[model samples]
Target: MASPRDPSKRTPEIESWMNGADKLERLLDRDKFKAWGFVIYRCTYRSDSEWEEFIVRIHKRVEEYLGYYNGLDLVGSFAPTVLEDRSFEGATVISLREKFNEWAVTAIKEEQGIDPSHLWHLKNGRYRFFIMVDQEALDSVLSTPEDDIHEGFVRLVNAEWKPEELDEEELAERGGPGPEEEPLEGCTEEDVGWMKVCWGHSQMPGYLQLDGSFDWDMYYSRPPVIQSLS
Candidate 1:
């Protein structure tokens, strides 16, 4: 069996995933964009068709926002009987760009083990991602102390967003936003960590949060290209 972290298993799929992350990292390092981040949409669908529909709709919605986005990446899983309880996840990376570029489709999965230092695991089968772009929001969140738990981060990550109001009858019947609009919850401060947000840096490699436990590597060496970002 191929160990999850084995670097020798460099399949095309794995290479694609690495390239995706690297591309995003390079974009961030350029410091050309004002702000960039990702949003985690924790949703479930009744059928594969429904999931496909949602993906198509979202892809279109993202296109409509081209005036405001430089590039975006959509990734996650689709399953029948998707539930709000916990079984599926998805995220959209929106890099508010000054110039437009072709959007990339690259997905991350637990099996990839892309980052050997920190393994990705589905904790309690649930987690959330937050995209804080507002200047004030960025300042507040990025201010979180290194060792301190980020209550602000948790609150924002698990926060629910209500849609434009509907008629009383429509609202009551639909029970408010459907499964796709459900708010993320049950995540605590202990379940999250801010990754690569170094002090005094404006644009740096950023992740939603460290998704899993660590595999501390004392002698690990980053490639020369990656080290240049420091």
Candidate 2:
């Protein structure tokens, strides 16, 4: 057998970029990735264009090279959010964790750094961050393969009526049902009709918190729109 190699050969410089322990994904426990099916990337960028470019490029990379296995999508979180003239001010976002492909994310980051004249080198720690999910909430949703789907549907149908209205109707149908009986407890009747429109609608609960991240500025600015993927 060959002699064992010395640990001295492992350079933090090479490992930092290649292995990307400097990358937040390296710091994450592997189970986090497997469980969540995604990760959050929180970073700061100086210019509005930098933010735009990062979002566009990440979307491009996923569309061109990634697939369902990655389950990748993005949100521009906390944008138009800036400190008073900090060198870099960027938003956080959620997407496929780097475990899906080290190079997919690292390559985009590296490419951005290749032409330093265009931008300043940013410390991943100073700029990038991770947002841990509510393990309990995530577990509740994902562990049980079923969703509150029927609950959501019932909510949609009875949104116009008061809670007591549904209760009264049910009691009349069931002949003055006992007070202990409760239908759809812990859930309210509301506008859940959108839930039936798409599978994503069911997942809205997990993602609803991300509504704050929606780039309303994109609509106001009116960038050229794409009618179709083709």
Candidate 3:
């Protein structure tokens, strides 16, 4: 499979960001690619610095998996916008609460068909971020069946939305079929089929925890833009 774009080959815009140490700007050149979707999330009760740490960790984790999957790119920002208050709080909380309520009610109705509580207790913290994912990669992962996907690849695409552990042991145990119970007709012991047995874990990106409410806009098609960051 083709590798990710080399940093050495980055465009002039990326070069500028690098020169200025604008990490997010360097990774997310929205004007150059169509967004497959957008994500908004907040951090669990913690300091702003902690939230930034989460962003860095998540970025590194995603980078590791990029080689395992194609068509994926990401860029994120924590800057406050008009929708967000000075503390970077209002917008994300409102949207997450709204979306969570809708989801909870729908789930409850599907199971018991009853009115569900619309309240979502806000967690303590003021860290919020917005991410835009390129369309080609997001669509490919979303349309594929879960059973047919590589665990590591799936984890990369959903890193922010559903933060999952990408451990090799967590993947279904793989091995040749168990020993045959009976011999085929006219087959002797010498005719028994032989199969190789393989074992052990493959390295996987580590786990991450955002620990806050969030929402996904899988159909976002506009050119990537985080107004505040811009």
Candidate 4:
């Protein structure tokens, strides 16, 4: 896989934030990313309900965004305490986190579905959340001009809420296999005879473990952007 974009290669604006020496120093000292690749944020919450509300609001926001760019994977969760040192390399991790937190808090407050009464101490620990883009998918997204990318993100965030409506016929069509049934051609008496011989001497386990390594280089890489929708 391509190494993360070198901080030096970033635009002046991005470079300035990426190379914030003090912030990097502090983050490194904290040993964030020690586990599951995460960084620590000392969040102070007003109450438990507020924390839960924040999560629900962000979940909806992320879902909307993911729908726009089907290729990207934007999953998030709340951790009891922030993980150590999990910021994106060559980027302003803290600033990005703060921006997301601000947006989420504001959205939660404005949306009636979110209840602030459950807000609790982020003081118990910081919550760690993340949004990651597959490099290949990101490359495709970035091929568009920077301005358009920003606009896309905005549209995702401000998307109007709509109730999901299902068409009964369509739903039934997707529900399962058709009413007609067919016999398995490969399971004839001859095939069963060969199978018995093959398995006569040994038993095979039902499952096998898969190694996790995968080829990420095949995908494209692109810079992240935020867009606004009119």
Candidate 5:
């Protein structure tokens, strides 16, 4: 098994998306565009056929990249169930997302011996990925002090998104925000720690809270690159 901290195990798109999403979270200051410093790019294919096609390509591509069993054990484990039914509507998206998140936790714990309850889990929207963290799980560990948890939690999610990265350490060290600095308009001091606090529940509502709605016209209708093996 690759080290629980293997960077090679993560796909490039996921890594790219994570970096972009983390920056967005800090800019937006609400943790609105990310789940654990990463963005889950969702397929917004308009038709059931399009959705199927996208999934098939990902299956082939991911399997080829990570080996058949390896891919199946990761996101592939949840892909079949979502693919079995060709509809990627609101209710279906919610259901599969919840299951995928749960299963990822179990998978990570089994494969790497790391507790995913603290790290963020990615959602594989056959068409569209969500920048959603396991909010309920995060809340459950509010008191998960930085020192007590494994350093791998941050790296496991994304090296760019640890508590130290998001917290006020730099500002504290430098004295504070700039002279003209002001807190985000309506947000509070605690609100700034949106990523750090325990909201006590998965604020993940229906499709809308997380922009959970499906807009089929918006998907990038292309195929993931499939590698050819000798």
Candidate 6:
């Protein structure tokens, strides 16, 4: 029998490729004025260390490319191998889905002051994690220390310390806004409002039609080239 793969040993290149595809999906959604396809990057990491490094690197790169993005979020899970289990794997797709759902519920509660009993729908081999963050909530969260934000999240879920600690480090590594940083420019207030509306509507199942099925081939296929925004 083949040895189980160690998700931590996966190269950063693979994670980068997956996240690049996610960014493409988001860009396409914005370009087409669509209400769907807001691109949530998902991956399985072998260890907490690997996951921490991956999150930090992605956040730094994203900040360099786009001053600051309130929409960006991450969730991960860590599972250890059991003794005498030769076929044990560190993480599974199901565990990741659970972690994401946990995060989504907490986020929704914190932002909306209401428990999210029906916040996610997992079907068609994909999990949907949804949250509503209007401008006010976004500004408030961004102003606070990233660690505090993460701690509040952990308190909401009553989860163990492992994932909570990982999330804290990930948020800290993202750093705070730079001195020269300014809110998103170019887009008018009306545009921002529209984007929020689109995001909200898209979270409802069947409300928006995604162009293609959520299959590996469809997701990893070459994306069309677009003119550079830079």
Clashing pairs in 6: 7-46, 8-46
How well is each residue in 54-162 modelled by candidate 5, as lDDT tens digits?
3344344334433422332333332222323223223323344554455555644554354665334323222122322232322223334422221111000111211
Listed in order, each prediction's TM-score against the native is 0.23, 0.18, 0.23, 0.19, 0.25, 0.25
* Candidate 4 segments whose C-alpha is farther than 4 A from its true place: 1-42, 72-230
Evaluate all candidate structures by whole-model CA lDDT and list the values in order: 0.28, 0.25, 0.27, 0.26, 0.29, 0.28
TM-score of 6: 0.25
Instruction: Indicate which candidate wins on lDDT.
Output: 5
Better of 1 and 2 by lDDT: 1
Clashing pairs in 5: 40-129, 41-129, 42-127, 42-128, 42-129, 43-127, 43-128, 207-212
Model 4 lDDT tens row, 10-78? 233333334323222233234331211112231323344543443343344434433333312223222
RMSD of each: 19.9, 21.1, 20.5, 23.1, 18.6, 22.9
Off by over 4 Å in 6: 1-52, 68-89, 111-230
- Alpha-carbon deviation at 139 in model 3, angstroms: 30
Q: Best-fitting candidate, measured by TM-score?
A: 6
Give the 10-residue window scoring lowest on summed lDDT in candidate 6: 151-160
Looking at candidate 4, the ten consecutive residues that score lowest on lDDT are 200-209
What is candidate 2's lDDT per residue for 1-230, written digit by digit as tens?
44333211223323333321122232223212211111223233334554454334333433332222222232222121112223112311111122213422443245333333321222221112122222222233233323232211100011111233457778788788444422232323332111111112212222221111121111111111111110
lDDT tens digits, residues 1-230, model 1? 44334221223333323443334434434433222333433233344554354334333433333212233332222111112323332321122110011111111223222232221223211222332222232333335543322211211222111124568899789886444422223212222222222221111122312222331121112211111112
Tell me the deviation in Å of residue 26 in model 5: 36
Clashes of 6: 2
- Put down candidate 3 lDDT per residue, 1-230, tens digits, no spaces: 54334332333323332322223223224222122112323423334554454334334434444323321333232211112123433333234444534544454344323334421221211112222112332333334443322321111111223323335655445353333434422222221211111000011111111113332132111121111110
Which stretch of 10 consecutive residues in model 5 shows the poorest summed lDDT? 150-159
Model 4, global lDDT: 0.26
